[model samples]
Target: MRNAMTGLALLLALLLASGGAAGAADFPLAGTWTLTAADRITPAGVREPDYGAAPKGRLIVDATGRYSLQIFKSERTGFASGDKKRGTPQEYADAALGSSTHYGTIAIDAAAHQLVFRIEGASFKNWEGTTQRRAYDLKGDRLSYRVPTAPDGNVPVSEWRRER
Candidate 1:
């Protein structure tokens, strides 16, 4: 009985040590999140939907700190030609402006309340191989962040809810 008790105590100690390490490695934002809203705040303080009335998006953050994000305007016009390469200038412009996508590794600076995205690729070529930072807020199962202000004096905001 005494030998068994000693072994159990040793096991408990090992578990405690490993648990601490795992907890340190665990990412708070690691989860699949769905976009709830994509909005822009104008200089006049009006909040308007940036991706139409109903935006569609998904964000997947894995345990390894890699992430994939995609957001699209639900009201985007379809290409009438049914061929991407044959699209008109207006169709191409609409397609480009109607969606945002990127995949890469993410790092969080909790002290600064910032998220740094090391984009591997993006729908916008200018974002490829770039590092972008955003101020973020994470509460309960909801996460929200604000993009850098655009030249047009609009501030974009993205809100997401974790998927069950």
Candidate 2:
């Protein structure tokens, strides 16, 4: 009887230590987050603002592991032709450089604490059908992550706050 009690105690202790007895939540990142700030840092320690000071964007992650994000500068000018489809080359170039959008599925690596985005479609032509791994942190209502460096040697960082 004493040996059985000792074994039971050991099992209980293991369960408590491993945190496996209380099942973990499945969807920790399922919510809408709005971008609060974005900045780019160069390898030479130069810092540049990204998407302007008061950028507008939304990031939505659904329970089904799908995600979409859009970020844009607030001061973008309207197309010269007053129509999106008829925008001149310069207007189209300005819009493309000033905004970003992507949608795809996300895979979380709990051990590594990183989110892998398997991008299906993106406004930036080069990013479509690409996979990007971003290290992320979630604290209270804030989420922050770093984007892979751009061709211009700038590393982008973005912070988002949960929407309600």
Candidate 3:
């Protein structure tokens, strides 16, 4: 009877291990991704780049739901002084406006086609402690999402392609 019980316990352990692997496999978005586009659609139906002509960014989402995202314009002007702390007001403004970065815990509601971000920190102070929800599309290796409308009556969209 003791030998039978031990065999049962081992079988249960193997089942649990396989179940965990299956769960991870079911989560398709847990991977590194590269930005494809960052654009905005104006109220007048004009589509324009939101992060300059050659925007650069990365999105990393882990199996445990933690994520870090960053986007930056390619044409940001460099400070003449070459010192971050000694940047002029215009340089500071340029630097601030040129990048978007945040780290947060992410939750996806696949049935709703939406994802929520519980932002822990952000380059933009206003978003540091905010919760944002975005409607998303996941097609094969590509993921796209739309941000909330901006004050300028434009809707921002970001597209990413899975890297791994």
Best by TM-score: 3
| Residues 2-74 of candidate 2: C-alpha lDDT, one tens digit per residue | 9999999999998777654343334667789999988888999887778887899999987657899999988
Instruction: Put down candidate 3 lDDT per residue, 1-164, tens digits, no spaces.
Output: 99999999998899687664657656778899999999999999898999999999999988777899999988888999989999999889889998999999988887888989999999989998899999999899999999989998999999999995
Candidate 1: tens digits of C-alpha lDDT, residues 1-164: 99999999998898676654565447888899999999999999999999999999999997668999999999888889999989989889889999999999998988888999999999988899998899999998999999889889999999999998
- TM-score for predicted model 2 compared with the true structure: 0.80
Candidate 1 backbone overlaps, count: 0
Q: All predictions: root-mean-square deviation over Cα? A: 4.3, 8.6, 3.5
Runs in model 2 lying further than 4 Å from the true structure: 1-25
lDDT of each: 0.91, 0.85, 0.90
Q: Residue 137 in model 1: shift from native, Å? A: 1.0
TM-score for candidate 1: 0.84
What's model 1's lDDT at 163? 91
Give Cα distance to truth, residue 37, candidate 1, Å: 0.4
Model 1: lDDT equals 0.91
| TM-score against truth, every candidate | 0.84, 0.80, 0.85
Model 1 clashing residue pairs (backbone): none
- Count the clashes in each prediction: 0, 0, 0
